[model samples]
Target: MSHPVKLYVYDLSNGIAKQMSLQLTGRQIDGIWHTSIVVYGREIFYGQGLTETVPGRSHHGSPVQIVDLGTTDIDQDTFNEYLAEIKEHYTAEKYHLLDFNCNSFTNDCAGFLTGGSIPEYIKDLPTDFLSTPFGAALRPTIDAMFRRPTPGTTPAQVPTPTPVSTQPMPNPELVGSILQAVAAQAQRTGQPAASTPQATTSLTSPLHPCANSASFKSLLKTHRAVVACFSNVVTCPPCRVIAPIFEDLAHKKGLKSGGGAGAVFTKIDLATPSGQALGSEWGVRVMPTFMFFLDGHKIAEMKGADANELRTQIDLLLYQAYPPHKHTSLSLPAMQSLSLKPILFSQVPNLDAVANKLLSSITSVNNSERVKQIITGSVVPYLKSRSSTKALPTVLVAWTEVTSTLSSSLPPESLFPLVDMWRLALLDPAVATWCAANFSSSPLVTLSRVASKLSIQQCPRPYALTLLRLLSNAFSSNVLAPRFFIGNFRLEVIALVIPSLLHGDGSVRNSGASLAFNMAAFLQTGRAEAVRNSNGGGTVKSDMEDEEWEIEMVSAVVEAIDREKTSEDVVHRLVASIGCLLRLSPFYDTQVSSLLEVLQAKQILKAKLQPGQCGEKGVEKKEVRKLLEEVANKLCA
Candidate 1:
């Protein structure tokens, strides 16, 4: 049955915004709007993460306006499933007052349920506010207000809307204990854990506030590069002048390097007693003094407030901290332009045929009958109707049971159809998330096991191809991908993929190339983020693991490129994988560079770039040749 969906709009300013906006911004905004979706006897909004409350009983009190958003035929079970899938994207740490706030979440939910959008006026509040001169001036203030708390700030100080849940929430401390136990067990056994996903703090705001001496010390200890500005904002005019410039530089550099791992910008006001003591300890008497710190020691300082000088020094610090890879200087536009998106095999096969094949492969009468029912009763219907509605949690639970039974009993060669079916279902983010979170029984574990059982040289073509595609599709889940990179899982993946790269079967090689590309893309993205956050340079083992994985993949890819005499498509994918592995890589100067030299990777690639040597002559071949040349240049230069 269809249910009514309404938008609950509240004025955060309590009707005062309309009265004062004209005077404050010289442009009248009707309200400082906060919105929520009211459906299924609950009011849902994004604040301190996704929250639900009894209608009209939220902390916002009663909404000023309720807009009829039309009705949705989506059932409560389906909607709840949808909520679980979307919750990860809407964490409290990810909320931004001017960007992704309450209105944005409502609009997303509205579209999902009703295939419509919230009113433009309500959605456009941030844009409208920022366009105004006064509103533009308030951007930094809005950012700082919503930013995650820096060190030394109590959790109570961070603004969070208290959620009134329909049911009692789980004990947070108990949940933490469970997660710690799981992680510990996983570490002891060298297995990947199904630990609860933690919300990562968003680093949207580059400037981290140093509240006192303790916070300042903590910041220096944690961050590799920090730019500390010591000044009294209330008393120092020059401090005010250079403040914006410093902030702007932080944002720019933070963006370039990726936040968190990059340089951290902080300000200490000498007007406060704590700030006064900090300044004394740093021996700063000037009205505005800029100190550059690397490895927790002050390396450079400037007494005057010079914008150009500040920019220059900050650039130098970043350069010294994160030296550009030699490949970055090469003219390799084709390699540079390679898209880092995961290469996915998403084509849907005949579901009935696949189900029949799976049923025929099962030997146990009871298990066979149960699997058949799941295919017809839950899995098939869910896959068909997933576009318009969500499957109940039980649908996935049933599939999980069926997967465990078959994956354990079925022979390695007989598992292709089952793996193929799982691959199709995993395209749904909901299923992917469930699989990612349920580590032990995850079909991904089954896929990995099946790959391990099959000899890389003698595996059936269909089974090998399906396994490769299944691994590729696993990257669909943001949650699963990261987990896959941890513990022994990463090594298992390397073991499966390296041999497949040089498989005698051309189709298996193609599938293997696609999987390799996906793996490389994942690493490249993480490396880029680390560089942006200034986390790439340290002796962190996670960084080392990533470097090791890349070096192994690159070695296999270069050999694959040399052996590949046909299929421009495979060549393109293989070269693209090499590019991603090398680009923005921290170990390019040492491990990766030395490996490339030993392999004579540049010469092998240049030989492939020669006309008629790599693949059949066509537009695709020309593209492959171009990529090969670029990769060759990046390798040698």
Candidate 2:
């Protein structure tokens, strides 16, 4: 059931939306009214930088035409969360009419909804107006009253900012009472009593917060190391802004969370009486202050909400308390005992013929960095064109010969030029597509296996990672998909390919994900090809056996998703693969079905992509959500 997302646009200039446009550029300007998103006939609106909520009659008194933004599979709660994140950033304090406004918010929501921006003309209205000389001259007059209008109330009645408490607070009695109350609560809650810090426990979480001087003393005594955050939750906005960041670093690091001997985190709210006393005791007046302590003595203090300074100071404390684990870096023993196996093929009838020709005539190495030229120079032109089936077999056989003749005494670096050339060939989509049809056979398997051998856990060599990624890239073309289920081929492919999903190297895991997507592409194209043939295309493609591809490849993809569950990149690719597989599956594979629920249960749905992560290639957040929704609705419903 698809829900059409309608944007209920209103021009704020009463009926002068056309006049406002005339004052600016010739863009289609919806009269300057506020806007809201109506989904399922519910008008969802935002105001004064608040989260999306059902609006009263004040907004959208007379709305413009409702835009049918296609449809979305996003549920209300998830959509609301996206709105909340927007509200957090586009707060009343931050909303600028010329910069960020309701239209900007609507544009963001529309982008999330349909993977398209709201009509460009509406989005550019403010900018269009501001750019003109007449509009520019009147901007100050117009901007003052319009940006953040209180829908139901006037500006005078808007909540006033709370003043920071500056009165000298040396309330020892109150501080002692607060400490006793916390201590009593801890006892009743069965929290660990104040005791000496133990190496095994990591002395509570670095984000374990304290409210007053007494709690701070208790934590300082118990943990022996502390990073106290002096923030104001009541009056200071930046203090509130930096509060979560202060805790997030601790949570991500987990040093103070019983992972190792790490620094303990404590919070002091200047708004409270004990907090006020503590602030005065520390000789601090400003909000969002940070002070580092060891053994109940302060060694460093930061006076502002500077993220860099906070991180640096916290890192300094963590370094002092819980130094880096010895095994974080690659060690000598792990490298010396590296046990790498080369991936192999099940059937190669013409191997000897190809190997004999390759062994007898080796291509000379060139000084240039162009790898495709080098490999092509070594082999025939048929391989590069990808027009003939004979090209794949010859290439595989030729590659296998190179690996077989190599001595164990030879260092992996000795084959750098050869690997570089291979990597380059795989870089080409034509070559990659042609190569993927070979599926789980010798050349691809051997290449991956050899790359795996070089991948020592916690000691990933750049070359090994690069080769694996290239092999993964090679499989990305559509040539392999239409032929994945011809006979016993799919099973053989899975047997050769699946273990790499669990490779300890994150880059290798990412590569395995790429390969899964490639296979998924094959699955989708294969299904479409089937539909095409069924619908009277005379191209009668061969035996796509029932339940075989789904049983083997779906299981392979599910296991791959499980193996790299922690990796968002891997999971993103795996989820896409599984979604395709489910559509392709005659009976939606149970393992794949359950996996979606597992991901949701584990909060993998809530997990955010890192900076610069805009999903895999062109697929963005909207697509990801749709894939998730398809699984959830079908399986759970």
Candidate 3:
């Protein structure tokens, strides 16, 4: 049997490019093309990495055009292997809008599967757009829009466009004359003119030479751990031998670990006058001497060109700075192997039905019209177009206002519809990013207010369930999860979640379990990454690590497991959360392990795993029982 392969074409600009291209650029561009490959009943696309979904269900929504690219005889397993290889080359970090994008991925896949290419115009869109004078002028704007998020800053920090009147305008007549000249030159020479060259900023490596005492002092001040090599490569043979080794370590340990958040490696040339001044100041008497500085103070010094000793000292410096978590030494294979991806509830209900329910439930005549406009005009369209394009700032601001208003004015019982809407919107990365950056003003405030109401008042099940789901969806943003875990709002969010674990309703309990799992997964991922990157040295403590938070969370989960009697699904998830929280925990010996012992977690889990005591039947019950056994064994160990 053979599977049919197809090409899905989307308009990155919707229909605006077709409508405005001639007037704006003096060219007839059909659309700003984005594409994906459809095969084996799945739509595979690239943006934030290569993602697969059901046909017509990607964030891009329905494709503007679909091209049949014949059939492929390759089996699913074979194609998957091919996809794995392709994934390495098309990673989220490497994604570039104009240079390399969705169309590039699809075109490659299409050629491999069906010996065909995506349309020439689609493949050449970037070149065509850049060829225009207006497009050339707009290059920097486009680059700014699509630039990757910096390590320390969120994407929300990127500037949005201001009003045209606020900025200086280019001369239309001059632009027209330039375009005409290029066209006339092309006609005369029977060839197209070259595109205007674009300027690119070059990145400097983490390992570079320090020229002076000021530069050396600045390096030590800026970095937590500075590895300074006092060597003149031109004069000394030993310096030449150790220079490459130092550079290799710098690239590996310094650059790879969160962009030099770890140790920074630099060398000082003794031959130079400034380097000589720095050497005399630091008392560097020997050539090829290595010195380690932690927090701007000299910690250790080494002489001669010993590569192994250099590597060892650097590792020791990192270890002293960042001790490994106590749990890393434990033999908890099951916990160590747990997935770190968040547990998200992203099933979107019908927007029309949700909107209708919200409108019908708003009893206040004064606020009803305003809420309606916000939902139907702002929220609905934003959600609808979110997969295809970024939402306008006005829409997000409108959402914040409406959510705040509704949470304040509407009864707790009548807020589920609004909460549900916000939950659905958080599934989009843009909305999630905005919510994270504007934490105080976002729907999170609404969620917190509702949670506070639940703490005191009798809240409706639908509202509670939707609220839990909303919290789970908030973990969808990589930027938001860290803030949610350890930011100022951490305790408030945790307090809201703990009680829900013991809710009477099974659905509420399940949703709460999902939320717990997300929190644990976030914490676990940080710990795991730190351990993996530590290379047998002491692991750096994750920002997500909080002794109090982990202890509180694990204690609640164990209690939830003891109380949960009906749903095996809920029990399984609860166990997973416990496993994640306990694994690679820095406070395992001092706090978490003792807390589990005090809570009688092993006994509770042992009771649950006994023959018929498990909630579910067949394979589900078997899996839950198996997980319970694994957790119980870890406790014993």
Candidate 4:
């Protein structure tokens, strides 16, 4: 027996604009087509977990439901706003579920709401459910919306003028006469016209107008348009006429479009613009430019275009990218390439740029496989051949994007080239500043990139303190794999970052302690020695005494810790690292005396008594005093 399907009306305005009916399929049916539901007006209830058991069910279960009234037609702006609200109101997984369900109502809604968006807010839910009946229903709507044309008045049609060939004719006499007329014109204009064989007559005669000449009449029909003003490049009259038409068309397409909503089409006029101005301003020297922009920033472009050719290019571009009205903030595919899981490395905002460039280069190389010698050359380098400054960053950024796109391991050789590219970016003060700025904004992402790069042995120079500091900061936030870095760096990144704990900046202090805690946890064995060797280069000789290495490293860490200020909460971390290190195999017992010296130097062992902290007459005055007494006894013993 078929269950009666119920209609779920969705009203997008108040946030709940749709209703879905579920039929019980089994004894205990739980899962349905989950999507991100916007529970705008739903009453939210929060309570602590119950300790006692319910009468018939497990006591562990908590009852909670996010009720969304319905979902309906929403423009891109409203859609983003809705999504942002949903993200704030629910967990990413929950929101992702809601998004899937919401998108399934219509194809346009699916693409509009989920397209080009970061799933950080929705990834945990079962993406497979996106194909469910609820999900399937929305697919058609999303597809339809995404397929809608970008708003622009249809291009005014122009009459197609007949094509005239400039090819030469076979008659020698006709060619001779045309040549003489060309010479006569050149003579009048005080310019020399070179002699041509009679067979080349068609070229010379086309420039002259002779009423009685059949060749001249034929030339008029053949050359429908002539250059009004001669120029070496594409400013010939016919091309110039077409250029403005394209410019106008691009402007109309770009009128209301900008930002990540979608790119707009624009034109950069070369002739109306002065010498080197267009090239300098827009970075081009060619004519008949056609550009695609997002919020006035040029992202993709072409130059030296004709009418039919320009139309083809526009169609191709539109096919690849949706218009603003049809777009969501970001595409799912593009956003996935930017996510943490598939990248295999830690996240870095700068690496996002790198990844994008790599993907672009890969695409270009693959696309041009069939047109090598005809275009740039068959073995066209995967990277661009522009000057080093232009090419290096592009290639590195591209590599980063590609690695993020590909879920599996990339070749070591492929990464070596990117390492060089990053090295170049690091050396360029401006580029380094940019990288640092991005790190500041998204520490987790930046730290992940650094960690991944290190894992691949990509750091070319002595690891900069700045790079280590960034990782340390990220570790402090507990936003990255602190153990990976702590185990990898030879020098105690924690020790260096620990001083930040005492700095004037409170955030720095917090970050420092975090780094120290994780670093201590990671330095379980002789990993520090390996790290030291990697960074400082065998400063500890292979033949050096094992006991001596222990003493040196312990002393270094203690000294670094002791240098921190009294107000800083670093003593706890220092003690923790020391405790962990001692518990690990290959103990550094010789450093015990050094550690005591450093502790004493910082007056860290000094006991303090608060007014209300006194113990009974027979008891120890303070915990520290009792502990110190025991320590003194041991040292003396």
Candidate 5:
């Protein structure tokens, strides 16, 4: 019965050793024997296919050479020769290497033979052997020298031998080869190939943020067409409500999709501050804007799309500009400006891509200088173009946010840009409406712009005049509670300008009057009293103090009412504003007394109409009678 003999040998040249074992297979041992006991002399041999020169048998092979440095009489001279032989073989047949010491070799051999024992020193070697030159070539040398028993060990316990590894161990060369194969496969598949590593992804690579315009531009080359939307009034609500729709449209499939051109949907408030920058760098202006990029170049421009309209326009632009290429398509083409695309609206689809393009282009400006240039040079003029209309109210909101952001936190010089933005907001009725609603909510914020907007009555009024119209509608619709105005003084400004309604330019004056009346009703709800009571004490006398302010407003409204006095065609808008105020004021009865007496003495009161006559005169009579009735009711109450 041949017992398993495990040998621990050392490679003197590389200063490491390993273990080998002979499993008891009832067959010739010659082939397996070579692997069991490695010869380390001027040559080190391990593995199969080697004839051993064992001693005395003419073959002279030491069936096993027990090289125990501690117990055996071999000194440094013998050790060095043994090491030299290992070197020769390793250099000639090097594969992968390992590191070890004597204690490590002993434990390894013991573990292999005993099945449960392993050497302490070799248990936790640093795995960085590949970092050294000898690491790759030293494995065989170490294995050959360490494959024999210690000098004093008894032969009874240690058999001559078989050498094989039953336990699993990592094979560095195999792993490395697998990695190279995988990388090659990845390359063939057109996927990003694995890097020089056999087994893991790299930690570093370029980051692509689809948020960037340049990135979007790159994507467009594949798609052939891209769409961008720009608007200034982006708040969380609009973004939540509206942005997703745009994204959905962008992602829609088989619309014979245009290759990816970078598309951006941004708010004007956040767009670049410079107009020239927006034009020269970002490529366009006039917001609530949209543009199409085809093959890396802007092919067309559009503006102000509600979701459906925007989709329609984009489809059209893409069809006209990018049409499906029967030929191979490349990335988007470089931008070309026939005369620089002009924005259609003041602000529509303001997105980050536009801002970035403009910002990057604002190099020559005097200061924090991006949006300022954009506002003054591009946006403002475009807005001023429709300053007399009532459609672009939201433009004001964007300008306000931009100016406010620039003025407060940006450099002192940033104020000039802000001033430019504020002026633009003031000039357009649409912009002013936006400012009045959003900015005027703050007294200090809206004072200057509100005052300026109100003072200006030029025709084709900033189409933003509709903002007031919208406010009027809100009043009539009562979405904004009548009682809401008590605490907000800014609404009073709207009231003060009320009588101006239907007076001066007739259309604006009438609109102004109606809005003022609505505001008065809002004031009449006594909301202000509650506010005053909360801030000051409650009392009807305190109400009188507020009356003083109301009186001044009343006087102004009266003047406007008189301006249109002779136009019997005029409406009774003044009556509504005044009547509501009278109901809310203690002095309403007292104040109208003199006017009532004068009308009575003039017999104007006697010019009565039959109960239901219907004409302009009848309407006038009815309003007069109603005003008298309200006065009588309040006075009597």
Candidate 6:
């Protein structure tokens, strides 16, 4: 389990006849070739793009020979995903060569895949030949005429970079050393990393009732991620109805059960002078208003005596967080002290124009056609394209102004466009991150704020699905890995994600499964590293220690992963997520024993496998069965 990488080497042609190319014009140069990193075999061969990477009766006449490179502390699945990205990159013409072709790709891959490369002879052949003056003069000519394109494509001019070495040399230990989390992240995401410095912000803790509006305002200004549960025993009869639910939820135990301890909940009595002042500032006309605040922004409000409505808003706010306080309550220095990479905004153009229109219109007419058009047409497009540039304070300001005034800015009849704009904005990580950090406290910036009106029972399915997808995109920092577990972010998002996973929409379930995959995969990779560094060290034993949350998470994902109904992508990702959880609670790890028993992880997976599920080829059920079998072996071992 500690070191888990395997390499696949292919001799592309039969006999040495394939390597035919002598000192000059067409001499005996027989050789065998073609290679791919076989890191996670049956465990992950089911994903797309395997036709070329998987060794079989390939375009090359002969079958491939497999080699064991052993494993590294890295998660083999993630490492495989990283390798997939590499194979995708190398399939390009710029990196290929006649002497160094597929073997060269394998060499680079082996280095990245494990701490070893193929025996040096395969890589050295090209370098040694190109070094001699006689061979050097003919090398370019030979490659130009003989080097072929990948079966279907036209061959491109291979750039004259340094050719691969043909002289045999020992593979250096340092070859694969540079490959760690950063390289894997770079390849997995397919984009350059952010240049911003590490940023840290204080996380809000669960709160008790506020004594007065002054205390409420003071606490509110200090941190983002707060919820004010308003009530009064004397005056408001309806406030009394939802008061106990609000009080219990404001406590640690209630927040713990809900998976939103990073959020603060306060009881504000509207009867008090300070409560009246606070209510006036937020325009509170009702008695029991559950106001959700993020980054000092009021995102959603449920003003009613209905406990269910109040709980619904609280759930949404909690679901949007990362590492709920129950998980963080133990105070592990490794997790709590980790420095967070700043979620900087990609500065957009025309900030003033967008802000001016929304502000002026909201103050006067409440909602204007001109404001919606500019936001939908201009504001969102700019964010999509330039979201990675740098943090734009002015743009953040505009977002704050627009979101804070959202309720008063638009009437119910014309609210759809603004919600549409919000969903689009959520897709951009920079905008999403920036919004979460700077504009979250303002009610207007949260996706749920715009999406609050769209009920699946009342609206079209796509509307609800779109909102869920927006939530998924907002948590898409799984690409970077850092943003997924830094503080309370994932905890908040998971609260929202679990319900969507249970949603009836296949597409909604797919997005939810993907989000689950990201969360579990992130946790698994960290735990994998922990396994390597210790004598099987981890303290996640007992149901209360980690079981309640981990079980709920895995159970939700397993329930959503229906081989018969789910899409191929959904099945694959969900299976991978389950695989992640299985790895965390491997049969050998006593620490994760509680999670193993309580979730019945193995039993559920076995029950889901049907007769034809693993037999079909095009449908991913076959691969799903294979992956499930592999997981079963690990869990039951």
Best by TM-score: 1
- Please write out the lDDT profile of model 1 over residues 1-637, one tens digit for every residue: 8899999988766665676454334456788788889999999887666778888887777789999999999899878876775675566556566556677678767866786777878865765665443343344434444455546754322222211221111222332343233222211212232232222234454465443465576557656788989987677899999988887877666522222245778877677655677799899979799999887988899987899999888877767765654544556777656777788888988888877787787767456877888877888777666652444568777887887787778776777887887788777766665665466567777668767766656777888899889889877755456555665777887888999989999999999999888877877665554554453432212322476777888889999988888877888888888887777666777788889999999988787766666654522456667877777875554
Ranking by lDDT: 3, 1, 2, 6, 5, 4
TM-score per candidate, chains pooled: 0.65, 0.31, 0.62, 0.22, 0.27, 0.37
As for TM-score, the candidate ahead, 4 or 6, is 6
Give the runs in model 4 whose Cα sits over 4 Å from its true position. 1-488, 492-495, 498-506, 524-568, 594-603, 607-637
Off by over 4 Å in 2: 1-400, 407-417, 427-442, 445-467, 476-497, 532-549, 552-567, 589-622, 635-637
Q: How close is each model in CA RMSD to the real structure?
A: 19.0, 27.0, 21.4, 32.1, 36.4, 33.2
Runs in model 5 deviating more than 4 A are 1-399, 403-499, 527-545, 562-570, 589-637
| Alpha-carbon lDDT, every model | 0.69, 0.48, 0.69, 0.30, 0.35, 0.47
TM-score of 6: 0.37
What TM-score should be assigned to candidate 1?
Answer: 0.65
Candidate 2 lDDT over residue span 1-637, tens digit each: 6678888776555554464342122233556546677775566554455434453343335565666677878787777655554454444444444434566566656656665556656655554554332233333333332234445744432121121121111122332343233222212212333332111111222344343344455456545468888877778998888877876766544331101245656676676554676788788878888889877888899888899888888777756654432222222231122211112111212323433433333334232223333244444344334343535556655554554444122344454334444554554444454354334443454544454454423223544554544454444333323233433445444543465566766766666666656665544444434333222111112233345555566566655654444556566666666655554333434343564455452233223233322334322456555554443344322
- Residue range with the least summed lDDT across 10 consecutive positions in model 6: 196-205
Candidate 3 residue lDDT tens string, 426-464: 887667756755666778766667768557125788888
Model 3: worst 10 consecutive residues (lDDT sum): 196-205
Error of 4 at 359 (Å): 20
- In terms of lDDT, the poorest run of 10 residues in model 2 is 160-169
Candidate 1 — which residues are off by over 4 angstroms? 1-214, 254-261, 384-388, 525-545, 610-620
Model 5 poorest ten-residue lDDT run = 200-209
- Which of 2 and 4 is the better model by lDDT? 2
Tens digits of per-residue lDDT for model 5 on 455-551? 4353234322433443454332121222223334444444435434533565556656666666665554443333232222111322112555565
